[model samples]
Target: EENRKFVLRKFQILYNRVLWIRDIESTIVIVIIIRAGVYTFLLVIVAFYFSNKLPLCDNEMTVCRISIAEVV
Candidate 1:
C-alpha cells in the first residue's frame, strides 16, 4: 500500500541519518583521545630526560638547559 511504503521510506531515512551522526561523533572522540595521549607521552619523556640531565651538567649545560626549558 502507498501508506506502508511511505512509512518505510521515512524510517529508512531517519535510520541512515542516525548512523551518519553516530559515525561522526565516534570519529571525533577517537581523534581527541589520540591527540591527548600523544601530548602527554611527549611531555613526560621530555621532563624525565631533562630532569635527569640537569643535576649532572656543568656551567655551559646550565645555560643550555634554561634555553631548552623556555622552548619547551
Candidate 2:
C-alpha cells in the first residue's frame, strides 16, 4: 500500500539520520581524545626540558624549592 511505503521511507530517512549523527559524535570524541593526548605529551616534554635546563636551588634548608633560571 502507498501508506506502508510512505511509512517505510520515513523510517529509512530517520534511521540514516541517526546513523549520521552517531558517526559525527564518535568522530568528535576521537578528535577530542587525540587532541588531549597530544597536548599532554607536549606538556610533559616541555616540563622535562625546562627541568634539565633550569638551575637547582642553592639553599640547603629549602630542599623542595624549585628554582627557575633567569633568561637574559
Candidate 3:
C-alpha cells in the first residue's frame, strides 16, 4: 500500500541521518586524538632538547639519569 511505502521511506531517512551523525562524531574524535598525539610528541622532544642544554651541578648525576629516562 502507499501508506506502507511512505512509512518505509520515513524510516530510511531516519536511519540515514543517524548514520551521518555517527560518522561526523567519529571523524571529530579521530582528529582530536591525532592532534593530541602530535602535540605530546612535540612537547617531549622540546623537553629533551632543553634538558640536555641545562648545566648540571657536580653531584647531579640523578638529573642526567632522569633526562635520559624521559627521552627513552
lDDT of 3 by residue, 1-72 (tens): 999999999999999999999999789756655655555456556766888653442257555444443454
Q: Model 1, 1-72: lDDT tens per residue? A: 999999999999999999999999789756655655555456557766888543332446545444444444
lDDT of 3 at 33: 55
Inter-residue clash pairs, candidate 3: none
Q: Rank the candidates by TM-score, best first.
A: 1, 2, 3
What TM-score number comes out for model 1?
0.44
The regions of model 3 sitting more than 4 angstroms off are 35-72
TM-score for each of the candidates: 0.44, 0.44, 0.42
Instruction: Give Cα-based local distance difference scores for all models.
Output: 0.65, 0.58, 0.66
Q: How close is candidate 2 to the true structure, as a TM-score?
A: 0.44
Which run of 10 residues does model 2 get worst, by summed lDDT?
A: 63-72
What lDDT, from 0 to 1, does candidate 2 have? 0.58
- Tell me the lDDT of candidate 3: 0.66
Local error of candidate 2 at 72, Å? Answer: 36
Question: Per-residue error at 58 for model 2, in Å?
Answer: 41
